[model samples]
Target: MDKKDLRIVFMGTPDFAVASLRVLVENNYNVVGVITMPDKPSGRGHKIQHSAVKQYALEQNLPILQPEKLKNENFIEELKTLRADLQIVVAFRMLPEVIWDMPRLGTFNLHASLLPQYRGAAPINWAIINGEKETGATTFFLTHEIDTGKIIAQERIPIGESDNVGKIHDELMNMGAKLVQKTVDLLLEDKVDAIPQEQFFNNEADLKSAPKIFKETCRIDWNKPVEQIYNHIRGLSPYPVAWTELYTIGEEPIAAKIYSANKIQTEGQLPVGSISTDNKTYLQIACMGGAIEVKEIQLPGKKAMKIDELLRGYKFQEGSYFK
Candidate 1:
């Protein structure tokens, strides 16, 4: 069937997922229905927050399915009734064989990173934290394995020196939307081949995976090199920022949220976890090899501000050490 005529069942949840979903809607593709995560409590008031995909689907008045279990007999039966010509899975959860295999055209997914590399939940965060010079997005058929489907198309984007996860996410989101359109067009025209990743051969470079992140994973490690530490802070920045607590005289322990930092010279006289500052224009903390200048930071119960702004209120003695 022609792609425009193909009945597409779109699946995904977050803003990332919405990009592709929007592309299909704007292009007038036959997006017969949508599958997204159910609304869950969010924010201080605990009011329900709907998924971005769900919101978009409602605006377009598309059919939506938010089943808690894809494996349920009734859910699977309902999915089969759509008779989707092709299934497109974006930033969504895994599908059971009963559902993913139900579509005649087979299901495909848009992953945040180059497949076989960064193949798990937090691909964008992991790529930035690892200081990768290049990363890209991929759309591939969905097989039994997670993010291991056959390759359909790929788009490479540069990761800059000052790049963080948040910046990369925006860039990729736009790129993903465009790529999705191209993929669908080619898919309908039968101009693209869906080949297993293993067909082209494989190596160590192809085995990277993305694992879930947690609070423990966001802690700053002073023992690591300054570059890695700095990347970690920025990679998780403006989100679950890499944080540490500090103790000062005549005050309660304060949390430091590092959004930006740079390497600086330190005599290493102070041990790791030590802090020394000029008390005016600079704040530097010791790392494994050198010190990282706190270019941007936020303390507990305060807004994120530059070093100079924070220094104004958080005065430290010339020799006072941080724990």
Candidate 2:
């Protein structure tokens, strides 16, 4: 137990990961090294891309390792040279047994969800998609199973009706930074007290799992309740948004992406999944119990725009219905 001074190896690769890393650096933690994913080409040109963590690490002048394979002996040897007391993993990929077991104080992770629940790659998106009112960040020891580890500390945050994945993502990123900083303080002072997850779940059953998101999963189900539908859209908003086909509010069938909308009531002659418009002020979609006013949308082959902007080039007939 190295009280007052602890050598840590920080492992992560995304903007989310950088949040924790930044806190560690700012708080004067003894971060011996950083391990992140290898650079890969992405986007239109598919040119090589340095990860957000890599860019931050470079700016901080922290030593970094971007091994293609975690099991590579050369990489493993290099990692051993860091002689870290603890290793903290954020939003990076899974780790190998050899690597995680090397640190003296053991490897820990900063997960997006409360854990034992939503224990997968896309916690923030799934939590919103599932309509959870409260979700949070957690710190725990790393085990063979992803996101299943001994509990260290967790901080809960409220999920408002208006909160989308984009909003929650930013919230968690900031929360994770503070959590990591506090976790490091605990590590340095030898005050960390880990509790086994099994104890907490001993009496509680029916634990939920957060799974990865796919393109097909992004499809909106108009048949479901409008509240559920609204949550689904917000959960994946601004990225892999829930989409459906609608023709100019009620015209020809065209694919449209709905980013933000609110549920509202409808009157007589209103059909489920129908569109109603003033053609001047509003474009609303009828639902099972109510109608939702479209705030932001994107039609096929066009950039996302507000209702006012979408109305400029595209026209929606009054009393027309959407499928």
Candidate 3:
């Protein structure tokens, strides 16, 4: 079958998913329709906002469906009208079996990690937090369990020593887009040789999960080793960001978000979370075995700033520390 004749129904929500959808549309693939989340209010104004996928679908003049419930009978009837030969999901919500099983060519998902590792909602973030030197993207068939389906194809990439989640997220987004197209071509030619998830791992215990990150998950524990603290900060950088409470000698604890930091090895022992600053250029927090020299930070109601810029106007109290 020619690529232009295959009727595809694409599903996705965020910017990460846009790359793949854009590739299919730009390459003249027959994307018959798009399904995205319902429009919702956002920001202080409470203005309703369309999802990234919805906005892009509008621009391309593609048919769209925003179902409040995937299993709604009306929605299912509408989806069936699209007459999709295949379905593609990227960074979208899980679908009911009825929806995934409806298409003739079956549904496939573009996941950010190389399965069967990091199988969950936040794979890119967890890989960096765990200090892994390598990670990648995968395309797989959808099944009953989340992210447990047979893999169609995978592409690997190295994680740089100082790479943050935001950096890795973009790299995989583009790479995953190409992989999606490749998977589609394989499907078109009837040449796909999918492998089960179990074939990649020796035991189930060796698998690592990438559960959804919460506010508490981004909290920095000062008692851990400097390397760990450093990784934690970078892994969540530019997003939910690692945070701590700054306690001065007699002042109330102030909350601060740490965006960038570097590990500093030292000799003498200091109280965990102890603050060391020159009152002009640098701010360092003591942790196990060393200190973390904060490079970028943000206080409540303030824009993110470099350490020197923050220190120039605000001074840390003599006995200030973080907890």
Candidate 4:
């Protein structure tokens, strides 16, 4: 079949998914329709916001469907009308069997992490939090279980010591986009080799999971080693930031979100969560093996600022510490 003649329906919602969809459209692939999250209210004004996919689809003048319920009879009928030979999902919601099985060529998904590992909602975040030296993207056929399908192709990338979720996300997003196009072409050419995820898992229990991160998960634990604490802060930096409670001797605890920090080896022993600051230029918190020099942070109701700027206005008196 001609690449452009194979009918395809794309499903995604976030900016991460946009890269892949853009590639397909730019390559003149037959993306007959796009399915994204329903428009919903957001922010202080509660204004309705279209998903990133929907916004891009509008720019490309592609047909869109936003079904409140995936299994709605009306939605199913409309989906069938597209008569898609293949379906591609990226950074999208879980699919029902009816929806995934409808296409003649079946559905494939682009996942942020290698299959059989980091196989859940927040793979990118978990990988960085775990202090992984490497991570990658994978394209696989869809089945009953989530992210457990047969692998079609994968592209690996290095995760530097300072790389955060944002950096890794962008890297994987572009790599995944290319893999999506590659997978589609393989389908058209009948050259794909689908390898079961089990082939790589000698011990399933040893595999790392990428469950969704929660508010409590982002809380800083100053009792941990410097390397662990550093990873915890950077892994969630710039979004759902790692937070701690800053309290003076008798003042109420203040929420402090740490965005950037570096480890400093201390000569003398210090209690965990103890704060050592000049109240002018630096703020360091003692941990298991060393202290972390906080560079950027945000206090409650205040904009994120450098340590110098925060020191100018805020004071952490002697005996103040983070809990």
Deviating ranges (above 4 Å) for candidate 4: none
Candidate 1 residue pairs in backbone clash: 120-210
Where does model 2 exceed 4 Å of error? 1-4, 202-205, 247-252, 266-269, 317-323
Name the weakest run of 10 consecutive residues (lDDT summed) in model 4: 260-269
Q: Estimate TM-scores for all models.
A: 0.92, 0.92, 0.99, 0.98
What is the TM-score (0 to 1) of candidate 4?
Answer: 0.98
lDDT ranking of the models: 3, 4, 2, 1
Which is the leading candidate under TM-score? 3
lDDT for model 4: 0.93
**lDDT per residue, candidate 3, 1-323, as tens digits?**
99999999999999999999999999999999999999999999999999999999999999999999999999999999999999999999999999999999899999999899999999999999999999999999999999999999999999998999999999999999999999999999999999999999999999999999999999999999998999999999988799999887777888999999999988876999998999899999999999999999998788999999998888988888899
Residue-level error in angstroms, candidate 4, position 189: 1.0
Clashing pairs in 2: 275-322
Number of clashing residue pairs in every model?
A: 1, 1, 0, 0
lDDT against the true structure, each candidate: 0.85, 0.85, 0.95, 0.93
Candidate 4 lDDT tens digits, 1-323? 99879999999999999999999999999999999999999999999999999999999999999999999999999999999999999999999999999998999999999778999999988898999999999999899999999999999999999888889999999989999999999999999989999999899997999998899999999888888999988889877789999878777998899998998776676999998888899999999889989999999999999999999998888888888
**Better structure of 1 and 4 per TM-score:** 4
